[model samples]
Target: MFEILLALLAGIAAGALNAVGGGGTFVALPALVALGLTPVTANALSRIALVPGALAGAWVCRREIGPVGPTSMRELTAVSVVGGGVGAGLLLVLPASSFDAAAPWLLAFATVVLAFGRRVSQALSDRLGRSVALSSRALLTGQFFIAVYGGYFGGAVGVMMLALWGIGLGLDSAAGNPMRIAQLAAIFASATVLFLVASDALSAPLLLGAMLVGAVAGGYGGAHLARRLPAPLLRGVLLTTAVTTTVLYFLRG
Candidate 1:
């Protein structure tokens, strides 16, 4: 009962964070690890559980979804799906010790990105005096790599996407947010399929179901709430979550 409740609350927080700005894995992955699942299994299960939440957020923002710069939405999504599947396959094939060793570093890297990605994007934009327009090939290539990261150990992948778009396409994060949510759904959906078929995530069915239910509710509500919350407040919440998660992971290591 305690584990179920904990997972449910973590899922709610994770789903809300993802809907607002990303970093859902920062919450869900750690929570599952605390529940005694191995790091690799926790990562896979968290991705599986969050799929519905990402989908719910995407559905709510479907009308606002659009292409990122020179890349068409269709092509970008295709790349994300393929890259995500490949990443998931990598996770399944890799040794569990490798994920355990890398988990803290991945969390730290994600936290740094969440903290400074926007500032860096803005700075680059200011220096250039215009959006650095990447060729479509470049944009797709960048997105594919990010999707691979998302599939392997997504933490702030949505924020990373927004930062890339902000720098390369001069797209505003607010304007690109819906599309971020949609692409997140695509990545997680692909990853989830791989996890279900190839991983041991289903071994903890109760916890997974609890988290999934909470994530769905939170995602739907968070998408609506995100429109109303002040931007600074949302960023503050996300940064706090990211920082705290990263710190705890480092300490645990």
Candidate 2:
């Protein structure tokens, strides 16, 4: 009962974070690991549980979503699907110990990206002396790599996508965020399908179901609340979550 409640709270927080920014994996993945799931299974189950929230967020921002750059939505979606599938396959093949050993470093890297990705993007833009725009091929290629990473660990994949768009297209991250959320859903959706077929994500059905329910509620409410909450407050919450999760993973190491 206690673990179920913890998972529910983690899901709600994670869903809310995904709706507003992106760092939900940092919360959901670690929580499940602490509760005794293997790293690979935790990653797979987290993706499964968060799918509803991702889709809900995408729907809420549907009107705002658009092409990341010269790349068409169809093209990006294709790359995401292909890359996500490949990443999921890799997870199933890799030894569980590999994931355990790498988890802390991955979490730390993602936290840094979440905390400073915007500044890095801005610096790159200033260095270029103009808004950078990528060719369609370049955009798709970049997105494929990001999608692969999203499928593999997820953590701050959305933040990384926004950073890429901001740096490459000099687009405002805020303006591009809706599309990021949509693309995130696409990545997670593809990976979830693979996990459902190939992983033991269903072993803890109760935990998964609870988190899924909580995520749906959080995702919907968070999107609506985002409009009312101050941006600084949201950033603070996300940053704190990222930092705390990263530290915990390191301590576990």
Candidate 3:
């Protein structure tokens, strides 16, 4: 009973951490494991626990949904949603060991994009500018790949989303919130349904209720904090998180 309560409180903190920087999973995940859940179960529980934070972040930044196209918003949102669901479904059949092993590499890849994301975004934007056509099918494909990675081991989905927008969508990674939030929306919805449905231990009533409250609180706090932080600091946070998560996962393995 006390453990469950602790998980809730800890989850909120993790959500805030995630919202602010990008490494809340490291915090919430370890806490869940220490509370006695298996890694896969912990992963599922963590997903359920963080949905509220993701949704809140997206809602707070609703106005920034995508490029100036009429259908851009629809495409990004739809891709994210479908990709998230597919990734979540993959979680049920895929071996956690495989995802866990690749976790460090994923972190490294996302972190590299984060570190140089601005330059990449600028260079790409200069070439394509704001007029480059966004390929929905390609974007959706990327989203699906990212979603699968996120579902299996979502250590740095934010960084990945930022890079995708910058590189793929020809958008300013640091400026707008809509595209990234939309991706998060997809991640949250799919993860929520997957974990809540597939993971036996995570399907508990008390846990889910607590997870819900904690996620919402943390997500709200995270978004507010993110909104206040400058780009330089946020990038620094991403760098630190990337390195820390990489080390932690490798050490754990």
lDDT for model 3 comes to 0.68
Q: Which stretches of candidate 1 lie over 4 Å from their true place?
A: none
Worst window of 10 by summed lDDT in candidate 2: 128-137
Task: List the global CA lDDT of all models.
Answer: 0.92, 0.87, 0.68
RMSD of each: 0.8, 1.1, 3.1
lDDT of 1 by residue, 5-61 (tens): 999999998998999999999999999999999999999999999999999999999
Best by lDDT: 1
Q: Rank order by lDDT, top first?
A: 1, 2, 3
At residue 44, what lDDT does model 2 achieve?
98
Give lDDT tens digits, candidate 3, residues 103-198.
556656666655676677678777777676557666667767777767666766766766666666565554645556556757767766877767
Per-residue lDDT of candidate 2, residues 53-155 (tens digit): 9889888988988887788788888898888877787788899888888889999899899889888889998898554578888888888999999898888
- Cα displacement (angstroms), candidate 2, residue 224, comes to 1.7
In model 1, where is the ten-residue run with the lowest total lDDT? Answer: 125-134
TM-score of each: 0.98, 0.97, 0.81
Ten consecutive residues with minimal summed lDDT in candidate 3?
Answer: 64-73
**Candidate 2 Cα misplacement greater than 4 A, ranges:** none
